[model samples]
Target: MAIKLEKVVETFYQKLEEGKIMGKKCTKCGAVEFPPVYACNSCGCWDMEWVEISGKAKMHSIVMPAPLSTKPEYKNLGKYAYGEIELEEGSRFNGVVRGMTKKKRKEILAAGKLPVPCHAAIYQRDGYKTVVFDLDEE
Candidate 1:
């Protein structure tokens, strides 16, 4: 039998390569897991299937990267921040959201907007590509 975690990662990448954003949907209960998992998080079911995601999400909060604390690994991920993200499928997570600046974060907060529409976008890295989300318009 394959390692559950490893299999989940493998399947996720395979789908991404095909330009399809896939997630795991539990058969035991109607729960969707992004960054797909082997077992259901909601009901602890092992019967899950690869389901395409709509790529729609929202930014519930923003946490700007600290100044003067640069990581060589992130030299390429220009202007990013760690923020709370929620998929339209109902999964919530914290991820790197690029193109976020301190001023922009404050501006967004000042507008009294905590959660804003966002969509998944593929980001190129030195080793492999990954996904990030972009703020959407009303």
Candidate 2:
């Protein structure tokens, strides 16, 4: 099981390198878990399979990073903030959103667009592949 779990994580990174966002689809309940897990979070099912997410999501809230709390590894990630993001496939998760400045985020809030459109994209970190979201213009 440990080796299989490692394979799952490895496959996730491999897909990210190819610019495709992958998730795990539960064979039992048909639910999908983004940031893919070895088993189904929705139904505790072990028969999950690889699935590609649509990269479409909605942003519900934003919290800019604190200057004192910023991590060195994230310094290269310009102007990103954390937010509650919901995927089009129906999964909800908190994720980092790139390109969102304080002013832009305020504009989104003032415009009454709390749940603005967002989409997932991969980023090449120093030692790993990571995913982040951005405003979904479409």
Candidate 3:
């Protein structure tokens, strides 16, 4: 089981390096799991298939990271916040969203834009790649 889990993680990063965001689609219930899992959360089905995601999502809520809780590895990200992200394929998760500053958050809230459009991006880390999102320009 552990080895299988490791393989899933490895494959996920490998796909990101190839510029493709992947997710697992449950054959049983047609639910998609982002950051691809090995089973379906909706139906307890282990029959899953890999699929490239659309890279499109909506930001449902944003929460700024506190100064003390900031991680050094994220310094290069430049003004980001954690938010509830819902992928176009129906997966919902919390993800780091770049380009969201305190002032921008205020503006978005004042203007009544609670849920905004965002797109996925693969970020290059020191020795690995990961996914992040960018808010669509107003």
Candidate 4:
């Protein structure tokens, strides 16, 4: 199971290196899983295939990271928040969203804009690439 999961991670990073976001779609249930899991969370199916994601998503909920509990690797990300992200392809997952702050979160929440427009972004780390999201401007 570990080896199979490792292969999925490798494929995901390879695609990210090519400037493409990939997800796994269950062949049986037509469910797409982001962060590319080996099995379908929807129907528990292991039959999946790689699919290019649209990189378009919406922020459902946001939680500011506590300063004391922050990870060192994410220091370079500046201001960000962990949010429930729903992809255009119907896959939902938690992801780091850039350009977030306490004031902005309050305003967004007060304005009743729970699900705001956001898009996926590929960020270069120390030696690898990862995906993040940015809130779309009004």
Residue pairs with backbone overlap in model 4: none
Model 2 RMSD, rounded to 1 decimal? 1.5
Q: How close is candidate 2 to the true structure, as a TM-score?
A: 0.92
lDDT values for all models: 0.83, 0.88, 0.94, 0.95
Write one digit per residue (lDDT tens) for candidate 1, span 24-132. Answer: 8998887899888778889899899889999999899998877777666778878888889999899888877878888988989999888878888876667666788
lDDT of 1 at 25: 92
Q: Write the per-residue lDDT of candidate 3 for residues 15-124, one digit (tens) a residue.
A: 89999999999988999999799889899999999999999999999999999999888999999999999999999999999999999999998988989999999999
Per-model TM-score versus the true fold: 0.90, 0.92, 0.98, 0.96
* Best model number under TM-score: 3
List residue ranges in candidate 3 displaced over 4 A: none
lDDT of 2 at 55: 92
| Candidate 2 lDDT tens digits, 1-138 | 899989998999998888889999999999889888888888899998899999999998899999898778878889989998888887888899999898998888898988998889888899889999988774
Mark the 10 consecutive residues where model 4 has the least summed lDDT.
66-75
| Candidate 2: 10-residue stretch with minimal lDDT | 129-138
What ordering of candidates by TM-score runs from best to worst? 3, 4, 2, 1
- RMSD to the native, candidate 1? 1.8
Off by over 4 Å in 4: none
In model 1, the worst 10-residue window by lDDT is 121-130
Better candidate number, 1 or 4, judged by TM-score:
4
Candidate 3 to truth, TM: 0.98
1 against 4, candidate with superior lDDT: 4
lDDT winner: 4
Q: What is the lDDT of residue 55 in candidate 4?
A: 91
